[model samples]
Target: MTGSVTLVEVGPRDGLQACKHPIATAARIGLIERLRKAGVKRMEVGSFVSPKHVPRMADTGEVMDAVGSRAEPGDMVLIANARGLEQVIAHGARTIAVFTAASDAFAQKNIGCTIAASLERFAPLVETARAAGVAVRGYISTITDCPYSGEVAPEAVVPVARSLMEMGCGEISLGETLGRATPCRIAAVIEAVAAHVPIEALAAHFHDTYGMGVANVWEAVRLGVRTVDAAVGGLGGCPFAPGATGNVASEDIVYLLHGQGIETGIDLDGLLDAAAYCGDTMGIAPVSRVFKARRG
Candidate 1:
């Protein structure tokens, strides 16, 4: 496949994190293995955060330790600070992701820090990780709209993405936390960020709360985003964003990309199988459009 899009499957970490129940280590390991079979080279197995805040991810270290060797290059775990970074490194994550927000209100709600403080918090960790030959990916939420602050300007989105790149983050994933964006809104944010960061180095992570997630994703790809952050079976919602939903499903993204002759190197059948696994495991029906259609 030429001109392939890098689909970062976040089902294991970002997908399952906000759920109520804790996942068994075996189930986490099984999902990782199956996702690999679906040709996902870069995936997030879990996050290294406090179990009190994110109980589902409490076993992230154990999950990583079990599947680290099977992960391809650029596999990631979310790290909040130096402490979380240590956990990620300890469990063998060669690449890690850190987060911030375009809106300070959203930042405070999500991470309990202002935008500047959150960046400050991650500064040392990024430096230490880079010196250790590890790569960092940055995630910025509220690109176009914030749950607390409401509308977020494209101008506000630019500096956050740029700062992450300047701080040694190789790529930055722009997040639509509320999933309320239209294609036009997505374009504005992408355009503003592209002025500072290379378009190819930008990615989008959209929630599907309003059913616009897939549309916004397609618009982003058309606007020159080569990478996208998605979860298998559409399995995520930020607790901070009230009534928020999951990312545009990995199964749906792969289906769209391949249909447009943009290779994602994923097997739709394998992805759907993972979707089924998540549905059974979470005790909720799969939410992705493709998953529903296939099941029907």
Candidate 2:
């Protein structure tokens, strides 16, 4: 039997968060419902960040209520700090994500705090999640190269991963925030962090700026990583990271894994439909080459 792989759909949250035009709350909820129907077991519904900072996600609570009301089992949210966690928990979110960066400059520019300070602030939120019996996931951005800092050391990813694990995060997702990571560099970071954390406890989030997301993902899986974070229709990018591309497309990743004889328990055709639905609803051409190619 092929080993299990979990695809965490970040479209509703990450995809919509960066969109300039305001997508209606109803449409956002519809997107999540469609994704769930496509066999996505894990979906990030929204973030609890300040609406002032991410006006796109200003309807966080409303989105949570709409999706959370019908959430199957593992639907989740991204909590940037304690306040965000509080809002999500109140909305009955079962899983929450705390984010930091492997590069200090990246973290500072993204969240206006130093790396250490960002980790410190997340500690209390992790503790709270543990107490509430909610699963905690950690996000470490710029694991490879940061647009602002240039080449980042692989070793830098370890401490952030370790800190999240120590703070009770069940899993840590290393993000190629600028989409500049190559397979070799991804392997190097994995090697450095696998010593401090179980490979199974690690997840990967890659962007396709250089068109290396799938290659990097294959590298991560070969090294024993299972969970991967992807967006439907390839609909997300880092606002703070210059020239960053959309994440690896969900349908494309599913297709790649299926071709490898890996059973993701996801319906690729259904997911492709979801990708199309998102593309139509958002009125933007999907960035997924797979979706475009198949449609053509």
- TM-score of candidate 2 on Cα atoms, chains taken together: 0.97
lDDT of 1 by residue, 107-188 (tens): 8888999999988888888999999878999999989888777899999988888789988999899999889989999999
Give candidates' CA RMSD values in order: 1.5, 1.3
Q: What lDDT score is found at residue 3 in candidate 1?
A: 70
Model 2 per-residue lDDT at 128:
84
TM-score of every candidate relative to the true structure: 0.97, 0.97
The candidate 1 region of ten consecutive residues with least summed lDDT is 65-74
Clashing pairs in 2: none
lDDT of each: 0.87, 0.87
**CA error at residue 25 for candidate 2, angstroms:** 0.6
lDDT of 2 by residue, 1-296 (tens): 26878999998888778887888888888888888888999988889887887888888789878776334458778988777878877888889888889999999999889889988998888898889978899999999888788898988989899988998999999999988878999999999999999999999899999999999988988888999999999989988888997989998899888888887889987888888887678775688978988873
